[model samples]
Target: MTWRWLLLLISLTACQGPDQGDPYRPYLRVADKDDVPTLDPARGYDTASWQFEDLIFETLVDYNDEGQIIGELAQQWKAEANGTRFVFRLRDDAMFSHGRQVTAEDVRFAITRVLAPETGSPGRDFFLSVRGARTCDKPGCEVAGLVTLDNKTLVVEVEQPDPLFLHKMALPFASAVPPEIIVREGENFDFRPVGTGPFLLAERVAGQRLVLKPNPYYRGAVQPRLPGIVRFVGVPEDLAWMRYRAGLLDLAIIPPAEIPIVLRDPKLSRLLRTADTLRTQYVGLNCARPPFTDVRVRQAMNYAIDRRKLIAILHHRASPPQGIVPPTMPGYPQRPEPYPFDPPRALKLLQAAGLGGGFQATLWLRNDETAIRVAQSLQQDWERVGVRVRLKPVAWGPFLDAVRHNPNIDMFLLGWEADFPDPSNFLEVLFHSRQIGANNHTYYSNPVVDALLEQAASTTEPAQRTELYLLAEQRILDDAPWVLLYHPRTMLLSSDRLRGLRLHAWRPPRLAQLWFAEEKTEE
Candidate 1:
């Protein structure tokens, strides 16, 4: 059968249930293209895993609807010693789903586990600023910065004052896990995670489905309204959309190609939700290699592409970025397009850089439908400016590995979603000379930019910090380490029966707040 017919058949079958049950059942059904690889907070780094982790685990702090940091497991926290030392008081009522009271020691264990060399967690680098974190590479070595001051309080000390430390604590990597469970389950702890969150994993089928039930032990102010959450994993976007139309899924991510079609349909448009996310999609130009090594060549490449046209291709779901930082981020300066499309100017700059004769380079990208389309658009645009482009598409997991490790990478298409709503998260993490093999995939380095980033990160005053970040951003833009593309808007179609569902800029969806609205019957 053809693809359309197959979807139609599935929809027809889905509608033929024997009993017309309540449409507002207290169970959410959602679909995603990826599966959560592991539930262990220390190991899982990708969004797919983090989404599930947000439901199953609780961090010391969390972002409210307004994106402000608020207490979660910790009732309150205070920063002292010029922001280098932090003291947190655990919520007296906080208890794990398995009925154990959450203690400060649990918090210390979670942080130190991520720092342990044996754990090999991706979050290790995120805590390198913690005192003794740099040298605590051995298995038994404790992080001297992390101290448990009684069962109710925890004290943390960093090597330097970091204004964003509380924000980092809100991340899933810092989620508190029961140490006894880890000791008992060992390697199996990843599959059987227990934490202090609103939901507890009840069922799991590899590459298929996961079921979560509300935790009775959860003592947070916001109780889960939904009795359970059912996530269908490893489902493609197209199939998920079909399932959504079939009434099998309460939420589905609208595929890039289907976005325009859904927007045009009056009925479907009512269900569409778009949120401007704190994300930047860009092409990393390898500044350490030839061609892009020259600032003029990098600037010319940035000017070659028509960002407006690219946004159009994305069905106006994105806004052209002015610089590396997304406009949604604080400290993002209001400015005109730095490199507006100018074919003549692009060629002139290339000529001035002594590269008037076209040079060939490979552009790596994830083998996704939307990424492929964007890469092709870039390929055509650069070809007009004497830059011959070869597109190399790899799967998502391997693509990240290649970009981070492969020295031969000339250019790559990637998107960075903010871990926190801080300018330093974008500026320092992506451009700093210190992050060269880490998040700085471009290998772009400038001593002045590095100093500015350091000054911005340490500055506690908001205005002064923003000014430093702006100076660093301006310098980086002139260097043109990346072809700043656009900030994408997250588009998802929600069932009319669902209520209180909203997209967050940086964090996962607030599942606890969501519920199914009561079905209305004709009077």
Candidate 2:
């Protein structure tokens, strides 16, 4: 019995040592933001949760740094029956961290679990195109679209032709799960996530920290060269910056207030890296309510704010956006000069809409210093046009709830990042009438815009789709459902020794290929 225990311990520690491929770097250290509301992949729609989930889960498809879709778990796939049906071939070599082979059955079960209404996954809308996906109201609710032909082959059939369906599968929500573990653990499974990715969740200290170790059975294009990773959660932004500067942390975001200080110092500035993100921040106006329901009033609000100045103050790392779609995405149209900072025009529009005296409304914001600054700037700008603004700052969870369902919410500060790089993600999900209370928080609806978006989704021709999408965008711009702000740039500070780091707009930095050189003393 003692000899058997010795063998079991040896088997467990076999893959725990430093990788032979890269002998120097043994661990990767990062800051885990406190903003991560949940570690549950299905319920976590924020950037923080997605970043950690990407390390622990393997999606069927994934995107490269250039936004090209590539295979992750599924070795290859074929689009059959005019893009409505897709057949995926899973690699027999792929295995979970628990020493179980990943199969087509696992893929089928994972997707259906997300679509199950009982899970209340915020990402359920992404899978509605799958046949019978809407019927997943309970546990074990069958998804007719998901079919496992064998251990390696799986098929999915959608109701209509969707060219972007493959891209959607690359999202972290499409990660494969082991059915046996899920059935055994039930609702508590996400706390101890099991997947076939480059890393496995070794420890999670509730909301404080999460630790990961490399999985030897991972069969992806990239593998974790580091032996372990530690993500420090609930650390204050300023503390994170201090730790990075003191060499206690390897990577962290440069706090907005500290950017100038870092830029002034040559040594610190050398560590800074920045890239424009695919997210667009905006102030949503309730189109269902009065005062904002009038197109003239909405347009007046759009013209009143000085976006360029606000970008300079609140987000020096951001670029002024002419439209909702960020510049990072393809097919973004060239735009005319933005509405132009003309207060007289805004005043005239307000008078034309019988709101010459303006109206009083509350502006909702999350409990963030940056958001509060932006809100104050807008309040002062709108005052010139006779609109009195009352500011209300709430915690993260309550803020989302109020913004999504509260009828009294006149306006709110929020942002959206594309789950996949396509115009339909913004046009159809954010502004389309069908998503009124769901993704369309503004309650915006236009028959013409809806028709154009629907046509664009179904159209296979690239040129035709672009034309239809652009037309819908123009219509939305004309209606002014939101005061489109700027697209922020994601900035990071890392030790100069960190190599092979690739930042992505939709996902977190790909850390599997990341390695570190020997530390050097600063000049």
Candidate 3:
């Protein structure tokens, strides 16, 4: 037999008891963006923050690999009164990292914190269905929709019937936090989080790195497979890939420029993995501004750009625009192509809008390498039809503020990934007038579209709700507030030694299921 087989045989022979064997593998390594903005679940709106929060926190419900809703903290939930009310039963053995049994009161306090104005949670809008949710700004404000019956049972009531509320519960924003700990630690509790997850935050080095270890009191059915995980940050994307090549990181993200080189290499190509992401990139116009206020000008801009060319140059894995709503989404409408690459037609439309001489405008974008390529491509495409464009690249936070507050910015390039798998999450949240100065950066508003979205949310029947959503999507497409670009596929590079690395479409990868192939399997 081979030496590897001999070692395995000896290990098996040396096993003296059922509780003893080779010790569990100790470490896992991965790469992330420059920094994690925040570890606080309530204020985590960015991807990096959500990634860390997802690993260290547990929500009431979660999505499985096939995108179906599954129970996490709660053992099971029952819907009654035509989906108006939901009753959840906590698992008897659930325990927080501090070794306290998780109770229903903890759930109530966690949600009340999100509702409090002091928390400043961007996800507060998601829970408006609860009675008195709109007016309550402080804890103990008598929310009629929330009630904890005993130590293990809780009830939630909504004003209208909503079948999608369960899906919303699976978001990271709904993850439970230790109420007593927060009360004692105050705002500092955000950085020092405590949750009932498989892993706990063991150490952090400001902007440099973060380390997590298996939770001793974890109550989940599956414990963390590795003893510990180390996440490195602030490393440039190219340099991170180099680290991956040298076996420093088990996982790394492949940048757009290096995709070709990686694919050409025989050894590197075997380790490539790809998944379709539920994300959409677009160039949003300021609908309230002077030139873009005209629908003809908006249509002209969309028609001038060559979308397929952009995809070929920067992203071979991206699919061309079907609509602002990704095609994979339920209830997506089949609509006619309102704008294709027609420079002459674009010129005519601009002339009709009384801009025959063309107009000067600025496009705002982030200062990332990929964003720069996208901005340059758009400039070239628009200049072909007489529109002069200037590119302004800014940092991420300042760019978000400028898009929301600066009225002079003619257009901006950005992208939105779905928080939940629903049509309302995309169509209504982004185009609804109520969201202006928020995610609706375009200031897009149409009374007809508004009514359709509201009706869809209130409707109980799935077929009827789908029709209403389709109508709203069509109306927004006709308005052309955003020149929808493409849906990107997620590409990840990892060491071949790593196994069971599955992707979650709406969130980050789950770390509990991953293990090194060389390690002996857990019982």
Candidate 2, residues 403-475: lDDT per residue as tens digits?
A: 8779778999998888888888888888888787667889999999989988898898988998888889889
Provide the lDDT at 204 for model 2: 79
Give Cα-based local distance difference scores for all models: 0.85, 0.81, 0.80
Best-fitting candidate, scored by lDDT = 1
Q: Give the Å shift of residue 190 in candidate 1.
A: 3.3
Q: Which pairs of residues clash in candidate 1, taking residues 3 or more apart in a chain or in different chains? A: none
Pairs of residues clashing in candidate 3: none
Clashes of 2: 0
Best by TM-score: 1
lDDT of 3 by residue, 17-101 (tens): 3224422224687765455667778777767778778778888888888898889999999999888899999888888888899
Per-prediction TM-score:
0.89, 0.88, 0.88
265 Cα displacement, candidate 1 (Å): 4.2
Tell me the RMSD of model 3 versus the true structure: 7.7
